[model samples]
Target: MKMTDIEKQVGDFRLRIPQLQLEDGCIHGLIGGNGCGKTTLAKLMMGILTPDSGRIDREGLTGREITMTSQRPYLMHTSVYENVVYPLKLRGEKPEESDIRPWLTRCGLWKKKDQYAGSLSGGERQKLSMIRAMILKPKFIIVDETLSNLDPDSVKLFEQWIREIQEQSAVTWVLISHQLSHIYRMSDQIHFLSQGELVVSGPARELLKNCGEERLRAFLDRESLDRT
Candidate 1:
């Protein structure tokens, strides 16, 4: 997918991107400090928000082929199993136990399958949300801070599933996170935004290791300090 001369204005902030390309089947990290239009860019890509100027070339991707999950995902007051299978049912696809059990079991939610989704812990809820997103096997997925506030064990589980999906399928992922560790570990490419501009973008390792932008360096330093 590509964006050329894209622009969107929200109140006093305006997001501008002259050109951006997301290679297919790769994990792309969208990173920046708070209020830096990272989520705006993501919303634009997901078609949740329309650009005021310029066009986004989706490379033939459709609404059904794309999905987005946020930090606080919406869940029905229904069974965990029902929550996971909701997307499938929406698409007129019948829910299959054979296809659903593995994800539930892998995410440690199989035993809670019959329990109410609202009764799960925060980490468990996030896990269920992710499972619901992944169950569709969408071609393009935008995960916007969905891993935030999870325990270490849950984070590790998420990491493992992310890597496994990348290895096994041609799914394109745009992971938006404040955690640099998650971005550096999972991203093949990185896009850094600052004050509504895409300041730097390149291979994840090279950009992180050799980034010389003052704003980016400061952000990285701040994140490191936060860790301590």
Candidate 2:
């Protein structure tokens, strides 16, 4: 999917994106300061919001599902098993326990399968959200600050799971994270949104090494310190 000459207005906030292209089956990392339009741009690309001007040409995206996983996943009052299997059930599939077991185990939630989903800890909830969103293996997925609540260990496990999944299937993934290390680790390309505009776009390593903007350089330096 590609956005061409995109412009959007949300109350007083305006996002002007001249050209943004999402390639097939590549990991695109989005980073920015708070309220810099990082999330807003992601939503626009996913068609969650309509641009006031310009067009999103998704002609290249055919026979595939474009989905998103939010920071806080919405869940019903149900068992862990049910919460994970619900998306599949909605798509006219008779999902079973066995079908959900592998993912549960991978995410360390197998024992909690029968427990109420709402009762799970914050990290567990994020893990559950990931499982539900990933079970179908959507062609393109946007993960927006989905791992912000996890502890160090949970974060490591989740990152490993994502790596393993990507190894098996080539899915285009867009990860939006405040954690600079996480973004640097997962993304092949980095697109930085600043003050409602896409300020930097390039390969992850090159962008960091060659970053010249005072604001961006400072942002990177600060995040690096926090990470360490």
Candidate 3:
């Protein structure tokens, strides 16, 4: 699937984008500074925003089963267990007892299953939200900075699970993060966005090696400093 020359207005600023293709079974990264419209572009791709003008072609995806997880995770007014199983219920898929607990454990939320989702910490809530999204078994997953609130250990676990998902399922992932290392670690292909337009894109390593754009270069510089 790909977005072809799309543009949208966020008040006075025009969020314009160039052609960007997302490959199936591969992880794609979208990175940019604040106000670059990375999230805006993602929203447009997810059909949350109506583009002023352009076309989105779902070349490999059916487009109906796209799942998105944002930085701040919200759950229904229910227990963690209920939130995790909500998607299955919506799909009319009766989740067996076996299905719920294992996912909870995999996400490291099993022990907190009985707690109200609202009571969970930010990291835990984000983790639960991600697990819930994955349970629905969507074809395309758009994660908008889901790891930002997580600790390093939790982020590691999340990334591990992401790799496992890519290996085992037909699901392709779009990870939107400012953590360049996380992006480098997870994404097979990447598209960099700046001021609502694509700045550069290629293999992750290549982009890191030859990031000539000022914005991307500074972003990478900060990322490297943070890593140390």
Best by lDDT: 1
> After superposing candidate 2, which stretches have Cα over 4 Å from the reference?
60-64, 225-228
Query: Highest TM-score: which candidate?
Result: 1
- Which residue segments of model 1 deviate by more than 4 Å? 225-228
For each candidate, give its TM-score against the true structure. Answer: 0.95, 0.92, 0.93
Worst 10-residue lDDT window, candidate 3? 219-228
In model 3, state the lDDT of residue 47: 81
Tens digits of per-residue lDDT for model 1 on 2-107?
A: 9999999999999999999999999999999999998899999999999999999999999999999888889999999999998899999998888899999987
- lDDT for each of the candidates? 0.90, 0.83, 0.83
**C-alpha displacement of 143 in model 2, angstroms?**
0.6
